[model samples]
Target: MGKGGEDYGKSEKVGFEFRDKIFPAWAKDVKECEENFQVSHEVGLSTSEVQKRLGIHGYNELEKHEGVSTLKLILDQFSDTLVRILLAAAIVSFVLAWLDGQEGGEMEITAFVEPLVIFLILIVNAIVGIWQESNAEKALEALKEIQSEHATVLRDGRKVRNLPAKELVPGDIVELRVGDKVPADMRVLSLVSSTLRVEQGSLTGESEAVSKTVRAVPEDTDIQGKKCMVFAGTTVVNGSCVCLVTQTGMKTEIGMVHSQIHEASQNEEDTPLKKKLNQFGELLTMIIGVVCALVWIINVKYFLTWEYVDGWPENFKFSFEKCTYYFEIAVALAVAAIPEGLPAVITTCLALGTRKMAQKNAIVRKLPSVETLGCTTVICSDKTGTLTTNQMAVSKLVAMGLRPGTLRSFNVEGTTYNPFDGKIEDWPVGQMDSNLQMIGKIAAVCNDAEVEKSENHYVASGMPTEAALKVLVEKMGFPGGVNSQSSSDHESILRIFPHPWISFYFSCIFFYKP
Candidate 1:
């Protein structure tokens, strides 16, 4: 309970606006989050200050790659390796057939040597491919473990002592120190002259640690521009501070950077060469077929050497001519058009792409998603979690007016730390502006939330935000915001109002702002 005896004038607790920013109220087994998650609250900080303290988040527990990469999957579907061997064997068979077609001729050494050489080359290529795949597997096995084992945060409304790191979510506040890589992204809710310098070389290509500060920066500032904010995967080089956790894992700014790298690796160059290769095969087949038919037809119609009186050997020679040129042309066409080895090269390219993607923390499950990433035209983004900090802080407050003697002067305010940066000149004027007084009274008198007077300052219990609302009412000049429920000022719900119950199993106060 580090905050148990801290300031009561104002508090550091805040809220953010995010779609998936769970309140940790409705989540099942929320206590598990306390054991594993680490979101801390400092006594006094703005939401922007909280944002500066927290760091970017990503997969604390890396999801297992359920399937092989898309390239591996796609290449696995190809029959090119089989076809290469088949085509090579066919070439050898064609050469042997040509030699057999020769009359009274022995098998030439050229025919045997050529086919044998091609077979050995194909074998060597297959061996080289296997070696590359084995090397890639080894590299994959050595990759960094992305999932976390434990987290550190607060439990049962107390200071961040310690917990695990993996259970972090958007709302959890985590305390960090020097040399500790921030477990999650957070806003600096409380820092006591703490100079935290973190290395951003991996994310920003910068070599030095960016200085941490609590200040408003221009919106156009680059990722490297926000001097106060710390990101994930960045190591803290110096100092310590209490950070109010903002976003965790995959929802962090650095996580978005990781996603971009993943998307880039997913997009690949077009496969125009492959498509053209297929079309060329079809064209070559047509050409070969036409040429072979014409050669056969000409021999049958005009090249037949038949005569009435002829010797047996000469009669055989007079038989219709075999088209030697057509046979050679057909082999040449098959060799040129059907790049029987091309599929293997394309498969190699795909494997290389898969390896590149692994380097970027993207495990490609769907083969076509790679192509789709390259071809994608639009991306749908959620503003709550993706765009906005979802980190809520009381940046500005306007007082309608203040009433003096109407409020029962409370002494607990003296113990709380002063919050006004630019000190106000005066206290409440004696009953000024009736409407403002009514708003202040209604806000304080409403029941549900409470603040306790501990050793020195009033510490809020239940919702930090609700506690902050009561602080607001008090600041605007509503003393104690309660009549009292006990003597000795030892124990009583400070903001008790005997109004109709709004709802049961619900924790809230009606502001009646309208």
Candidate 2:
């Protein structure tokens, strides 16, 4: 839709024409933005070209809204009052066991054996449920992690491997491969007739892999020039490269706007679902508490002649030794009133929820996350193929230098090359190339991205913004030297981590002096 909801798709002058007409004043150069609010720029594509070439979108732009996380359901089921009471009963039973043991040696075990075994069984079941839930959380955290495995770059006149991608100052020739992740943004200088499917889900908010090509771009472009340039974090769907490292880490396109992620709500949203689930869980706990209280009260009467099985011996009952029966039945009542089986049931419910969610694509990490899902007033979720339609489409195309061509098709063709329209048949392919070739080569050669075809779609291993550059190159034709394509996990390395941030650091590349 246009600014006013008009279908600019039908208009002939909306793409390049509209962009050329509205070049904003502040978008002129690097100095325009605040010095502290650092901006990223690629040489081949201008700011306007970049902006016009790409659209501002958030990830998860395409997805069906599912109601709640499985964890939430689990938490809702976790509030069984019987479970709570049972836990207390278990503790009392353990104390009673110790009391018995103190009165006699191993023979005293009989005094506590009945309740002790009951509580232990109940607690064991609860533990198993909790263990299962914990396992679910662990399973969700296994997403692929990207790391800096020394980049292959041509420094004086030979190919050399270095530990630092940051040392690759602009103008350095870097070698790329199918399985390599883009360590930094670069301009492609050379390549085999390779193909790389770059995923720009981070930048344009489009998650699907975009085809790339080596073509020139507009002087005022904003997003296209960097399309071929691979950044850090994203995976390369395919291809190999020898690019000129243009930008690194924080200075790359994805890095600058990384902060632009919509700030999460300070307070969580109180959804009806959460409120109802919470209320239900709480009510269930209360109901169980009430039921347990009544059951214990009724069952107390059934314990007649306790001396037969326990308590004072039947034969010595009321013996005239003047020895008072030492039974503070009230405390016993309190401890016995707690249902020992509730906690186990509640925990089992939670574990089930956790398991269910894992199947639906929602990964719950923390123990509280199970309950938190039911009470998630605010969720700061990643906007990848999640909230949005993971299947990204070329909704609108704004050609910068091409001859007033209208790219109105909305089909999601996943090929790594630009589709030909009847208009393009009449128009020379030269138009697409002249405007995109250099931009493509620069972005591709300068990139630190690796594209690989996974089980299904193409994935990039570098920066998403750089993947955008590569995808754009292939999409606009000019496909000669640059390609975004590659292979997958042929080598598996195992490392033990003392902390999670270490893994984050490995995936999160940095730009600094080597």
Model 2 C-alpha lDDT per residue in residues 446-472, reported as the tens digit of each score:
555445566655664544444544554
Instruction: Say which candidate scores most in lDDT.
Output: 1
RMSD to native, candidate 2: 18.1
- Cα lDDT tens digits, model 1, 45-137, are 334433443433333433233334546633434333344433554574556556655753665665555455555545544544455444544
lDDT of each: 0.46, 0.44
Off by over 4 Å in 1: 1-151, 157-164, 218-220, 270-514
Q: Which candidate is the best by TM-score?
A: 1
- Give the local distance difference test score of model 1: 0.46
| TM-score versus the correct structure, for each prediction | 0.42, 0.41
